[model samples]
Target: MRSGIHPETRPVVFRDRAADTLFLIRSTAAASKTIVWEDGVTYPLIDVEISSAGHPFCTGTARVVDTAGRIERFQRRYGRPATHRG
Candidate 1:
């Protein structure tokens, strides 16, 4: 690990737009915008589209992004039917 070569990492607030949530975390990301946190200290603001609060896997509402469709199509093109082994 290098000392001064790495970007400055500090406490930043990540706001999930979709979930309407805010959490403080240490990150290297920076922003000109700032907001006062619960501790009454200002921190850099980072707006995110999605986070664990709104992610499909975390929410258990997975979305099919046509990848499943592609797999189904490939299987239809080259798959064989199961035969009775008994």
Candidate 2:
């Protein structure tokens, strides 16, 4: 660690608009807004479109892509590659 080498970090409130959730955590991020937390303390407020609370991967709502099916369709449409002969 060195002096004057790290960004300042403080309690910041991240608001997940999609999930309507608020999380207070220490972060180096900055915001132009502020929010009063549950502890009655005002913190920098940063609004996010998505977070773990609303993300499909975190909420287990993600759909697995059918890569095999897509490959099959592509091959059927274009046929297999031709082998090169010298």
Candidate 3:
């Protein structure tokens, strides 16, 4: 709560190129470019490569790897048999 000791937190826009999405949130992130939002107001625009919109985790596209299944799939595709040695 001290004055002049913390970076200013202001409204900024984050753009996800992968998802082609734009989010308006308050952040201390610095921006070298600006863009006019839908409200006809200009805000700092930060370009991001990934975000929830484009992330597999959020989009339910992530695969849960099963070791046994993975080995079988790999063997089938590559024709390298999986060896189990005890």
What lDDT does candidate 1 reach at residue 11?
Answer: 96
Runs of candidate 2 exceeding 4 Å displacement:
77-86
Cα RMSDs, all models: 7.3, 2.2, 4.0
- Candidate 3 — worst ten consecutive residues by lDDT sum? 74-83
lDDT (Cα) of model 3 = 0.96
| TM-score for each predicted model, relative to the true structure | 0.68, 0.80, 0.78
- Superior by lDDT: candidate 1 or candidate 2: 2
Query: What tens digits encode model 2's per-residue C-alpha lDDT throughout 4-65?
Result: 99999999999999999999999999799998988888899999999999999999999999
Q: In candidate 2, residue 6 scores what lDDT?
A: 93
Give the per-residue lDDT of model 3 (tens digit) for 32-86: 9999999999999999999999999999999887999988988788998668998
TM-score of 2: 0.80
**How are the candidates ranked when ordered by TM-score, highest leading?**
2, 3, 1
Question: What are the lDDT figures for the candidates, one per model?
Answer: 0.92, 0.96, 0.96
What does candidate 1 score on TM?
0.68
